[model samples]
Target chain A: MWSINYYGNWIMHNIEITDLKRLTQLVKDNHGYDFTNYAMSSFRRRVNRILDLYNFSSVNGLIEKINTRPAFVEEVVNEITVNVTEMFRDPSFWREVRDHIIPNILLNHQSVNVWHAGCSSGEEVFSMAILLREMGIEGKVKLIATDLDNSILDKAKKATIPVKNMELNEKNYIRFQGSETLSKYYKEENGVAVLDPTLIENVSFRKHDLVRGGIFNKFDLVLCRNVMIYFNQNLQNEVLKKLHESLFKYGYLIIGSKESLIWCEIANKFIVVNNEEKIYKKIRD
Target chain B: MKKRSIRRSGIKYCKVVGDLGMSKYKLDNTYRAIVLGGSAGSFQGITKILSSIPDSFELPIIMCLHRLKHVRNGFVEALSIKSTKPVTEPYDKEKLKKGKVYLAPSNYHLCVELGNSFSLSTEEMVNNSRPSIDITLETAAYSYKKRLIGILLSGANKDGALGMKAIKDNGGLTIVQDPNECMIKTMPESALQATTIDHVLKVTEIIEFLIELDKNYK
Candidate 1:
């Protein structure tokens, strides 16, 4: 870990360290967002990128501009927490979920609660909803979409996607062999597809921090995909335990395709389901 | 792309000596192993070729790369999006199992020891990088011997040559990225100089070779 040294008060200017400290402090103070635990190297990269973009010679100059201009702060925060995702990002994984995993859950449980822990911008939540609806268990399902970013969550609540993304997502949906046409799920207005509000009715889009504990009740399936990869192993294990506690006996846990339970202390507890897809079914005595 | 037969280089010692003999029996029947090495500009290409392999591939793969120190982001996650095979950075004392990929962790040199077990060391950086291609290839040469297949991919420095030589010295197969096709040719070029490279192919052709090797042996 590279630690940036701070000289007491004001001695001279080490603009890089100063900018990182100032922005980090600002995030904590303004939004109660603590990015302090994030990997220092990645944090430094984003900090330097923002500093270069604004061409600020000093951290104080950047601070003054951000305090005066809220949009600049928003951009900085947004840059630090970029979430890139797509609908049914891995079609094969989703296929496993839709074909092999969901049927078992339906067979075992009368009702299911699926949690998308880091449900950034809601593409996956909708995808999950579509999966349940296709299985004829839409009404019996409750999907909780959660993210730390309220702004992104607010955008997700609207369920309106860009015209370009909708076209691409339509193609993706078709490739995944979704039973319904993409147009059936949403109405278009001026090239944008406004997703049907009915689809997310049972789905609650809320601001929940994974770092904070014990919000949702026990869930039958938890799809926390591609989110834990950013966390260190300690955090990954911590979150896995929390997710484990949130799962009912014999519940299912699915992770990103690359992520696995092997070597994890929790591996003994879950039976592997399509290890390549990283789908696991919780097995408890 | 040449019809010329590329024969294995050097004097063929008629007698496979000691552990090499044992390893020859173990791997003489096996021709598939996943090999990964990287430097700058490797993200997209690595993922593309890896994902092109089948998810159910039965051979073990070893991957080495230079990672920026102290980044917690999942290099495996980004690559997994492009690969059908499951990817993971190896843990200390993790047994070298088949059908999985083991990546070198950041700031660590990942190597294989005897008995198909992995060893990680934070020893002084080689070639100015902890995940030096030389360290991995050297260790693999000692462990897998002829069972190994080494790949030298995009890199800014000549780090993999000594390691590639180790692989060659142990009678392992070697492949170098075509200098004209590599994103960074230095690493592959160095390996080409250090040993008699068996294949100098594009990324796509390498993928095809791997698939063919996987099918042919397993």
Candidate 2:
């Protein structure tokens, strides 16, 4: 195995492409978690991080752990998937949603159906909830949030975030120009900001793997921001198709500000509503 | 776009001759990509380098520069104002093309994948930087191997030191902005200590070198 000395202290074993294929195949066969479709570079980096975090000597060592302990697969899955997210990330996108997209959605539909695909730790779902509440349409929207990792989905259900992250979230909220201060929505308890439970009360949190899961319901707006960045072209096309199918005809699809649908199979079906914020309107069934 | 196809042919030729080892090439037309890493005081230097390069420069230029995590919109536009070639922040999995410039997006760690595409991560910050110079440089080193040109510029910290070392170790050409001329020498000085850099050029000299390299492609 090839290794590199990080800071001349710890040697990081380079997780080769062949090793990734082996690990992904093993996970697919044994645990039924399909990670083969993940973008190889980022997935390999995450696996490399796991090796260092757990002090595994090599990829084989990680494989050994996966083989011996059935419960360890959950831990591996958690580590493999990235969960870094914040409230009101890319605040301009949120602003565009409030000023234009929501009003546009409400014009045709009395009640909006929203899906927060890959909602990590619930910041974004809560952000949407708060936005709907401030618009006085909280009761008029049905929200469903899903993630690949059950642990993170549980955290999302909890609606609590560390106090340290609140400052950045608050800054983002201000930039988003919300109806009220972000603090008005959450309470501080023992160094964690506990969001108002009412905000997420109607929201259903589920463990849905975008790669393997089927489309359960059609939505008026689907926010799968920053999630598809982890997927390869084949998986992205597949997921985009599922996302497209999950949306009602002419419904809105808002992705991360930097994410694009231009290169995907579904590109021709969606009209670019707001290019800078990456808001799209599905034009074709 | 035609330039890109030509560059692609160059890449295929490089691969055919690659097993013979890269050190023998000496910055010939074999290089496929150019990666640059900078921090604190490097923006001016980088902009100067970017603005100076001709529009005909064919190598894909990938940059990892430290910027505020929350503030995202202005950097690319600012870089584009004077750059001859358009500057862009590539979306995740976007393929790298010749004759284009790519900046690491804010709040994301930009990585160069083996397939000549970008893979971004929300992974924890390395050396307190989201677009960690080390990650970009190391990954670029791995992907491009000897066909990469890595340049370290002025910065307050040592984020790019290990990256420069990686580029050097992978038989890629390594360059650092001259410490004496840098606004803040910590970054280049750190790289100088970390590895044997190929050229320690001033900003103008770096621009000239790039122009000369572009002429070779012509």
TM-score of each: 0.56, 0.91
Q: Candidate 2: deviation at residue B145, Å?
A: 1.2
CA-lDDT, candidates in order: 0.70, 0.87
> Per-residue lDDT tens digits of candidate 1, residues A37-73?
5433334434544555566666677778878886676
Question: DockQ values for all predictions?
Answer: 0.04, 0.35
Q: Name the top lDDT candidate.
A: 2
List clashing residue pairs in candidate 1: B51-B83
lDDT of 1 at B164: 84
Candidate 1 docking: what grade?
incorrect
- Give the per-residue lDDT of model 1 (tens digit) for B117-170: 555544335677766677777767766778788887888887778778878877
Residue lDDT tens for model 2, A168-239: 899999999998999999999999999999999999999998999999999999999989888888899999
